[model samples]
Target: MRRWTPFVLLMPFQFIFGLIYSWGTISPAIHVQSGWPQATLDLAFSLTPLGLLPAVILAGRALHRLAPKTLLAWALTCFTVGGGIGLLTASPVAFMLGYSLLALGVGAGLSTAACIALVSRLYPQRRGSLGGALLALYGMSSVISAPLFDEINRLIGWRPSLAALLAVYAAVGWLAWAFLPEAPAAPGRQTAPLPLMVLLRQRPLRWALVIVLMATPLGSASFATIGHLTKAIGVSSALGVLAVSLMALGNGVGRLGFGLLADWISPRFSRAAALGLNALAALLLLGVLHGYGVWAFVAYPLLIGLAFGGMAGKLPALAAHVAEHHGEAAFGLLFGAFAFASFLGPFLSAGLGMHSALQGLALCALAAMGLGLAVAR
Candidate 1:
């Protein structure tokens, strides 16, 4: 396969990468269909990271033994099967089961890990810029999809919406699979891969993973539960779609801006700035949002989105640096922390009452800010 094929195949990958975030857009409809509580819906959102991060771990391992196209094939199959399950409406249990399957597929990190490995190997000299571009597209997926999803869900209902989306994913996945190539030979003195447990024992690597664990879920859990959040704050729940779009905008801008900033300035400064933004967002969640109504919602998602985006962009580069030659260790350790946070965040956010849950998140972010600064030093 040509070197440029994975980059082109990325278009189809992008089509499905952010399906996990669609919970905010479609949860309302799902609630109407199943008569499930907001928290249960959010639980569905939490499943993404569970499926995703583990898939990431598996994909990271599989990249050594399997071709990228093979992994992409697996990912596409998961999405298809998961989408099929999600379309069933026999009962509430069936709907939840379908969502669980879709969550598994949506967050499946098989293709993501495959694509990252392929790109990193094929474009070693330009991986940072290229990866930033990839992250930007990941963020952009939500921006474009949020409104489109809302409109479609509004018009056709969530189940049919899933059917339409699956059709698109199928067409796109077919192209992506046909074109996706394996990682080319890594151009360097190849070190024997280290044991993941041994790598985790190292202080720098361990700390790096902790940072990723803390930073990723700040806005995201709240994002997964956005419709409920708006309703709790006395606004129309549907307004959450607007918040999702803005958050995605913040995310895309931060992905590029922070990635570039890290290259130009320092990851330390960038991380610190990102952490501070997160803390400020927490402050909003803790205090101001209750009184001001919808206007308050605007500031919170944007701040959290930027902070989350900044860290998402900065951390992979940091992991690569901190772990040095241990790419697999980086994927398992640092990225694992990311996947773990994906599970922990929304499960807690939606599980708790809105103000209290957000308040807890606020405190966590502030604590993380202190740890982040200390680690940077």
Candidate 2:
């Protein structure tokens, strides 16, 4: 039981950090209530990734010297302050700043790269399984937070509901920080940290980046646009929230399931399989665009969630596999590059329009499948 304490403690932070995924549900609500233009609302979500990119790059580099607890403290502070600002301010610029700050906090502290690096160091022998479990909670975060936020919004209002969320995040983040054990020192001859330029120059790392660039949009599109897509399909607002919840559920399962699969088989096979799922999800979305029934709504998000979760679960492992020599420091830079691509997915999707976005996702998956196969060679 004591041995399990670290992982158990890590779960809530992962869950809270995952509220980023709940943006699909939250964005639509804000738009409906505030009458903000779609572009402005979309920008709020986009700023998260934009903020995350630099913070993650820095956190990845800094983790070698700083403890996870230190970084997590920073993350908690940013998240709380950002949310507090959002709670107080109604101005679009102010809200964007608040959301961007939250994203920066997420990138700097609670990122998947940080979580994977910390846990893998603690449980070196079980890196794949442990990484997956932690990330699964992260993926599942949306499932729990989205519905809870929706209910809170229904009861009070979006602003107060957001405040309630920040309060919970603060409490949980503190507990996780207090309980998290120090990351064990690297066991073998530690290689010097690779420069970002050198890491990017490697052939396999470049391929991994390509795979991320292609696959991330498929998942992010569903995350950012699902509520609108559900309504477009003539579903009720209540059902739209349900679709977001279901996507998150699928996201959690995919993270756990694919993480374990990568451990059991190989990261390469797991990635290929995930991309295949993404391809199928893209097709499903196409069907929906062509006037498929409610079932298309149901099936589309589940598959995309799985693909997204699996991709998120596997990519870190794949980067580690490709750059094993550089160790955790390198993992941060590699994963940070992938995060940049992940950001582009939703940002572009909002601008491109839904049907075109889905079509673009299909093409990306197909392209990634070829890239995955080539990398395997």
Candidate 3:
């Protein structure tokens, strides 16, 4: 039980923060209830990653100055307050602000950088597998939350259901706070931190940046507008929500599965394979756009979700591998850089129509695969 404390305590927080991925479900409801344009609702989703970038940097720095538990407490408070605001107000601006506030809390408290840093300290040798497991739960959050929220919306209404969801998140956050351990202290003779400019100049980090930029856009587009895309393709709205849930399921499985593969084989092989998966997903999306048939409705989401999860699971391990001597601080910086690049997808998707967005995603995936293969060599 003591050995498992980190996993037990942290998993819940990851799940709660993971709810951010369920924006596909939430955005559609907002569109239906408020009659907001799809693009405008997508802007709300895009704001999350934009907001997260700065908060992650702040949290990474604060980890040295404050207790992890304290940061997490603040995260919970922000998320709950944001949700409460969303519940009380119907204004789109207020909703975007509320979600942005939630993004800040997630970045500052329950972020991947913070979690990976802590877990790496605890299980340095198994960081790849452990990071995969942690993020697998993160990907799965949408799988569980989206349909649950959709049902709640059906039974009551979107606003009330949101309040209930936030209430549960608050309870879970408190539980995680009570149980999560303080991060272990650093070694007495620590190496000096690398300058950001120097770190960015390294070969592997550059490749990691390219990979993140290429892979994230498709997943971002799907996550932001899967429900709308499904409906546009003639699927029922409920089924559209279900497709998002299934996509999330695939995302979780891919994370867990691909993370284990990285541990078993090599990070390079695992990443290349994941990029291949992304390329395949992109090709399928092209077929879907051409009216490939009903199978695409099921297939595209699962494949893209898998590719997305694979990228998320593998990238940290890749960073750790490339910067083994620099330690977790360096890993945090690398991950932060990757996170900044990842925001492009949702922002791009927000402006483009669905068909054009899919075309762009295919091009992005193909380009990523070509670059990834070259980098692997």
Task: Return whichever of 1 and 2 wins on TM-score.
Answer: 2
lDDT of candidate 1 over 283-375, digit per residue (tens): 777665557445666688788888877776665556566666756447545555766876777667657766676677777788888887787
- What does candidate 3's lDDT look like per residue over 7-67, in tens digits? 6787877877777777768878878876889868767766766666656656655555555
Residue 244 lDDT in model 3?
Answer: 73
List residue ranges in candidate 2 displaced over 4 A: 32-35, 103-110, 187-191, 227-245, 283-298
RMSD of each: 3.7, 3.1, 3.5
* Model 2 local distance difference test score: 0.73
The clash count of every prediction, one per candidate, is 0, 0, 0
Descending-TM-score candidate ranking = 2, 3, 1
Model 1 segments more than 4 A misplaced: 1-5, 33-40, 88-99, 102-107, 146-157, 187-192, 224-244, 265-269, 284-298
lDDT of 2 by residue, 86-117 (tens): 66878888778875546333543345556777
Residue pairs clashing, model 2:
none
Error of 3 at 126 (Å): 2.1
Please state the error at residue 166 of candidate 3 in Å.
1.5
Winner by lDDT between candidate 3 and candidate 2: 2
Q: Global CA lDDT of candidate 1, please? A: 0.67
Order of candidate numbers by lDDT, starting with the best = 2, 3, 1
Alpha-carbon local distance difference test for all models: 0.67, 0.73, 0.72
